[model samples]
Target: MIKGYKTQIMDYYEKIRYHERKALQERKDNIKREHPEILDLENEIGRLSIKLSMDILRHGNADDVVSKTREAITDLRVQKAELLVAYGYGQDYLSMHYQCSKCNDTGYIGTKRCSCFDRYLVKLYYKSSELAESIKTNNFNTFNLDFYSPRSDGSEKFSPRDNIEQILSYIKNDYIPNFKNHSVNMLFYGDPGTGKTFMTQCIAKELLDKGFLVIYKTSDELNKDLRTITFDNDKALEESLINCDLLIIDDLGAEQITDFSVTNFFTFLNKKLIKNKKMLISTNLLLSDLTKSYTERITSRLFGNFRLQKFYTEDIRIQKKSLRQNRFSEKTILNQ
Candidate 1:
């Protein structure tokens, strides 16, 4: 990926140079054609200087010729400046100008990368993630607790809505204080339709916006990609996953586990734990389900590292439908 980015920058630099050269030549030609009077004055000055030097060389007493040459040079300089002002360029027209002045159209600076190159890498990275919609649609700003019911009359008096709101508040505050560093690994375990994936994506978007490298992948999709890994670059994906600022493993336990997958996952988790990188896991598996499906060792490691947020209640889909119907009925009555 890094090599590809470098090549891309080189290609961009070549294109920029091509266009700038064309523009500079066009500017020079246009000046000579459109301002013929200035060009004529410059040519006359050069001729006079050459003639005066020849005269001095032919006859050693040519002081008057030298004085005339000096006056002609000064007047030509003034004409050149006026011509530059008429055209929208300064007298330094020979200087190469670049759209990206930091790089001088060369997409790199010294041994390091240029600002435009860095921005290109960033854009490429985001494109590879392929989650622009997820980033745009899910964030702290779009998340609203008002959509959830606040009634405390169910079997669990303070409902799932209240529980999730508290979790949201804690997450917001946690990100504010420790987003730059000291972030805790989180395991959002719950039943389906309880907002586990939504919150995970929201957190991913927030971290990504703050310029963190966050890789978000579902277990099933990731497992499919892992199957194609060659003997070489075995560590490439693993390194990216473990070394990124945040790794979000969503829909865990949804993939059919193979030996290669199990081994790779264990290795990934172990390396990330050793490095203390934040890993956020969101799954529909409860602690009991996790212990039964995966080994106790994996479960122990997860519990030891992650702050568990267990979501429990009636499914949110049913609640959303009921709430929509209620709002519709109220609207009809108001119209009547």
Candidate 2:
């Protein structure tokens, strides 16, 4: 699309230049033939500006020439406005005289990037959304901390809501200055439906906004992909997974642990650690289960590298289901 736009922009620029040149010559010709005493300051300003620019280009020290060029351009602009009014054209006619007024149709702005270059960056970011989609589109704004209950009911004493809030605050503040400069690695371990995945997704969303590139993938999907390829594709996925700006491997212990997968997972983890790339992982299994499922090296690296947060809760799905049934029964009786 950008290439196509570049071609179109060039064509549009050529057309606009042709029209401006024709207008200028027609103005000069009319003055020479008809309005000889009208004092054609516009053409004189144009010639002075050309001379100034040439002088700057040749000398390579353009302080005076640049100042004079600015004055000449300003004078010609004022003259053009007066001429347009005299000839019954409006102020809007100036827009059609140049395709890009900022760069004056040269396609570059001063010494830095142009608006077109910025647009190309925006396009590149939009195209690079395969990983970003998992992060940006799912953020803390979409996370409902309210869903977490403050108490663990009459059974045992634990506070999931308080735990979640602490986790949330830690993630938000930790990323402010330090994580922005140096990335942080984390591990989320817990029972199923206890908000491990939820918290990891929230972090992914936050770090992405802080300008860290993040890739969120389940261990199951990653292992499957690795098995399908032999060499090149395998290397590419390995590199991306290990060395991305941030990586969140969700559902860690869920994949069937074959020898190839166990080796690959450890290798990926070790490489990320070596590079200082941050890794956040979530697992349904405890440390003991993890050790049994994966190798001792993988577990050791995980414990050594990541700030571990273990989630504890009765599955919220079950609680919500019970609540719904009781609510419906009450509503039916009230209606009766």
Clashing residue pairs for model 1: none
TM-score of each: 0.65, 0.60
Candidate 1 C-alpha lDDT tens digits along 1-336: 222445666787798899989988787677687876766776777787788778778766558777666777888778777777777778767346788888887766897666676555556666666566776776777775654557655666577678888788888887535776785899999889777887887887776766776778898866755554435465555555666678788988998876677766776678789899988898998789988777777888899999999766566778789989999999999999
Model 2 / residue 164 / CA error / Å:
2.2
Cα lDDT tens digits for candidate 2, 1-336? 112334444565566678887876675565566544334665666577788778788766557767767777787778777766787756444343555577665456777545653343333443454545654655678776666778867553558788787777887777534774775688889889887887777776665565555666788877775664334455545655665567778899888888888987776677778889887889989889999988888889988888898787778678768889999999999999
Model 2, C-alpha of 329: deviation from truth (Å): 3.1
lDDT of 1 at 204: 78
> In candidate 1, where is summed lDDT lowest over 10 consecutive residues?
228-237
Clashes of each: 0, 0
Off by over 4 Å in 1: 1-118, 128-130, 151-158, 230-239, 323-336
Error of 1 at 148 (Å): 4.0
